[model samples]
Target: MAVAAAVIRCRRLNIPRAFVISMMINAIQAAIGRSMDPLLTPPAGNSLHIKASSVDGVQIYTCSGGEWRFLSASASLVDSSNSSIFIGTYAYVYSPKHVSAIGTWSLNNSEGVIAESGHAASEVTGRVIAFRGNKFALPAFLAQASSHLFDGTASLVSYIQQIPSDGGVPPGSSSCRKGSRQVHIPFEADYWFWTQDRQPPSVPSELSAIGLMIEGFFGTGHVKYVFNGTSWQQKNITASMYDVPGGILVGRFFIESHADDAGGSFTWEVFNPNGWTVTAKSASPGVQVDGSSLPWRLFSVTSASFNESFLGPITQVQMISTRGGLPPTPMQAQAVVETWKIMLLQWSFKVCMKISDSECTIT
Candidate 1:
């Protein structure tokens, strides 16, 4: 009985030992299996939680933010986030739906400077350049055509027009003639005439010539000529008469005296070069010019005038007219005047001059 008891004790001991041995063998096999097939086991806990789609080759575990380690000893760690991870290059994570790959990867190494499929040949070859602030640098060859050669404020149209090409004389100088035989002559020292028929004949009766003569008479004024096909039209005549302050002159003169009496009254519209509009009209029939009636005589001098506080600072002026009646006879009418005249008063204020056929001094 004693021997049997001892044998039973030994048997029990052997059973435990054998069980322990079996457990040891199974643990070794499990470890080997995990090493051989990395995908079968779940990644270790307390490790990085990498998205399955963000990596390939092996699973990566991160103990903390920005800290990563591989689960399989054989697999290596690769950064796969879309961030600059290498020198002068960036990383991008990618995973195909069909594959069971996981972990971080170095996108720069496999993908190169540009992606294989999405980028053009030039971009893949590193020809493309990028700049800060989301800017882009064009290739040198492309820059030759795309770059601006002129300053931002340069105007091609204005530059071309100003390139010494003839713009023709101002609209008003179209009718102006140079010599005494012509109806109009520009006011210049060379144009001053001693007689009506001579080379330097008397000033033409046209407004342009009259303006020049008036400038000579005032000793300090300028004359501009505009041609209306038949005669030179004078505009913006500024005459500084003797012994007058604030004496700036502004007026227009019509070459055709008969225009006013044609029942087609002339309307003179004045405008400063700055585009301010002002108007002056010829005295109408039954209207008073220096206290007289219109149609008194065709070519009769009549001055209808106006005044404004803002006429000062005026550097240039323009005039236009429209007529609407049959021409009048000389005896039946007086010399017609179709302009506004402003003269400085003794007090240095502007005073309008309203002259009639008899009031004006023709000589």
Candidate 2:
């Protein structure tokens, strides 16, 4: 009777028929559960629908018939941008699909505290790139595209030449032009740094911007002779690398370290961004090794890949035996191998990728 009286008064006034009808529908639906009775059929997977409510007195249950009773938690209506929606109390954030370049492209929290982007599992692990707590192809934030720090003329003089933006750093700078492989990735900088920062430790202050210190593969399993700064194989460095399962890495910067390896001083690890629940150390191990004596060699991830190297005292045994169990001769003139080596193998377990991002990935 009250509803009818209100409608009659509105009609006599200037209320439109459509508005009256919408208000009455809302009121009636509120009094009942929803417009449609809760149907017994479950909503199709990945699809949304509101079936008849499962109401027992005041308590509400979902339409899907599973548990003898999955009780409903309290929900509040949300109004934003001129629309109304409902959401649960807990929600997780994920990396964006389209923004591939190396920058924090999203922040779910309104306070701007969390930054999301691509990051290596860590300098030591180097197994998989990560993002937003998962594995992903997100690019490591080397520098802005215009920073020129990765443009082959970096003040630090990176051991790597400026390869094309097309993922040629690991194989060879020339691999891209020959189309030897498709190194398609979300990053624009394909680079390597033999030394932790690539520049001489005494470089000008302006060149202190920092670089990604990584493991660059060189000469057939590490033992190499250099002449005039050139390796015996006539090559120096081939690539810096990590393992990616199925050649697909998805993430935004949140990384994990692999378990410890007691056999060797270094450990290899990776993380997946696809919600993998593996326990991981969130930071890279602070380790570094020198590649000054390492030479170029072919390395492979799966079977079809090549050009890889790592940091180890490959010649340490040879150096020991050089004395022939007697007094050592004068060190071989340091010129041939010292000045002519192809690439330096400076290994560092922990490295700061950017000049300004100390422990920033965790932030």
Candidate 3:
């Protein structure tokens, strides 16, 4: 196998034995994680889960060769009130409508607005432009902030995710020709922005980089977080909790225990009839769960069936915040265990390979 060859090469290169083993473990985890969600796997490590904005835009397509090809996207990033906060675009284009827009602004504006002054544009990744149809699924994206607006919403943003939504597929090839030129199809999606280190007030400050913020106490508690530009605060819930992996999939089922270096697992099947089941594929060492000595682990969704799913088409999931979920130490003992935890599930994009600042589109 290719993995076996890679390991042999690593050994031949005089690499540390421990480093080689860690690399192999990560490779295996990533491979299994892909089985959970093929297209939208969030990058591992620490990152602050920030804001989610609604995007109403058009997917542009141009007829070329013998088929219709995707050109770019033109959209508006709106806030909770549905008011346009910034413009979203793929390539560079100067809009005549707004002076200091988010996507593409004049490199040299008469109002003294320029990229050097921090009024730059944004670049997007994770769009499935080649496929066209109702069933065509677009992957979730991660957009890096280049030049930011003065208001500071997009300033601290390290990445942006375009959550899957309906009505974005391009027109059929039968409708376009070489002479058909370009067509704009209207579409809507939610874009989640992320920073380096920031947490919601309800979530503990120590547990950072939460893609999902979950808070509950044993079987009877509440789940609080945000999605699709909507706030979900203190939603009541019920479920069973287990210290080990397997079973009916209600509450926390530990797959990979934090205490173990080889890692363990856990699953959350809180929503019955149509809920998501997230499982831990690996363990991230160092950081401890909120108030506990146990390190928080990241999970991938193995199955999902929610009636009103905020995690549309499924993306990335991780237990960003936690409180009192670890097994008791030798001295501590209790008949009943109640724990508070937060799990974040959002989609992510792979870093564009071989990219330059002048051309940042994912190739």
**How big is the positional error of residue 76 in model 3, measured in Å on the Cα after superposition?**
1.5
lDDT of candidate 1 over 211-325, digit per residue (tens)? 1111100112333334343343444333232111111223323233343433323322232442222223332222111111111111222322342322122111111111111
How many pairs of residues in model 1 come into backbone collision? Answer: 30
**After superposition, which runs of candidate 3 have C-alpha atoms over 4 Å from their true positions?**
1-56, 81-138, 144-151, 198-363
Q: Which candidate has the highest TM-score of all?
A: 3
lDDT of each: 0.20, 0.20, 0.36
List model 2 lDDT by residue over 264-284, tens digit each.
Answer: 212122233212111112222
Candidate 3 residue-wise lDDT, 1-363, digit = tens: 000121211111123644565476467556544222312322232143433344556777778776766666666555534455444333323344532232421111223334344544423222221112242554354333434434223343444445656666776768876579688777776655544332222212232232322222122122333222222232222234421111122343323334232232344554544444544344234355243413443333433345134322332233433322233332432221222233222211111000012211221
Q: Of the candidates shown, which would achieve the greatest lDDT relative to the real structure? A: 3
How well does each candidate superpose onto the true structure, as a TM-score? 0.13, 0.15, 0.33
Which stretches in model 1 have alpha-carbon errors above 4 Å?
Answer: 1-246, 255-271, 275-363
Query: Once model 3 is optimally superposed onto the true structure by TM-score, how far is the C-alpha of residue 79 displaced, in angstroms?
Result: 1.1
